[model samples]
Target: MDTLVLRLQPGDDLRAALDAVLKTDGIGGAAFVVSGIGSLRGAGIRFAGAETATRIEGDLEILTLAGTLSPDGSHLHLSVSDAAGRVSGGHAAPGCVVRTTAEILVAVLPEWRFSREPDPQTGYAELVPRRRSSQTL
Candidate 1:
């Protein structure tokens, strides 16, 4: 396993930046978001049972972030607190704009490949992890 540490600048979209890491050379196509923290000017979070994300605007502090990342897609969850101390958490979506900085740590798994496939039971695309030989990498 290898690791990547990144500090995202203001105005950067949190989700898009993470997705770009998978396309970088030597990433080996799969990674897990070990941890992340930062401040966001605005965020888009999809709550449980919600079809679309709710736009949250204001000075928000990221409390936690974690998930899997693959070329096929990513599944991340995060919690954030507003200036008023209201906390919200759910599926992390695109359009989460950084305010100050976003510090992230990712674990790259070179021997494994991950993809998303539809699961009949869940009726949603889910992660499918597979092991590949060194030759493939």
Candidate 2:
């Protein structure tokens, strides 16, 4: 398995950059181990319980980003700061825009491929182990 360390520069969209990497490497699935510790203009993050998105404005600092990446869909969560220096976190939605830059490190397991499937019980798409499921430890 190979690990990919990606550093996104200023003026780049965090999500978009990751997508580009996936396309370039022909990677349809993977996982992101995010550790953001920098200043940004601002960003939008949606919590799980919130029905509607709340606007968080001002200097933003990445607190944490934990989630998965797959062909089916991306289940990402983001945490950013507000003008009052309050921290906010939630599921990364469409409105999320990178302030200045975001650095992300992804563990690209070459031997294993990841994908997303809809679970009737959950009513949402989530990352799932692909072909390697048959292989036993």
Question: All candidates' TM-scores?
Answer: 0.97, 0.79
State the lDDT at 17 in candidate 2.
57
Model 1 residue 77 distance off true place after TM-score fit, in angstroms: 0.3
Stretches of model 2 off by over 4 angstroms after superposition: 26-28, 131-137
Best-fitting candidate, scored by TM-score: 1
Taking all chains together, the TM-score of candidate 2 against the true structure is 0.79
5: Cα error in model 2, Å: 2.1
Q: lDDT tens string, model 1, 75-94?
A: 99999999999999999999
- Model 1 misplaced stretches (Cα beyond 4 Å): none
CA lDDT of every candidate:
0.95, 0.64
* CA RMSD of all predictions: 0.8, 3.2
- lDDT per residue (tens digit) for residues 33-54 in model 2: 5554445565656678777666
Worst 10 residues of 1 by lDDT: 21-30
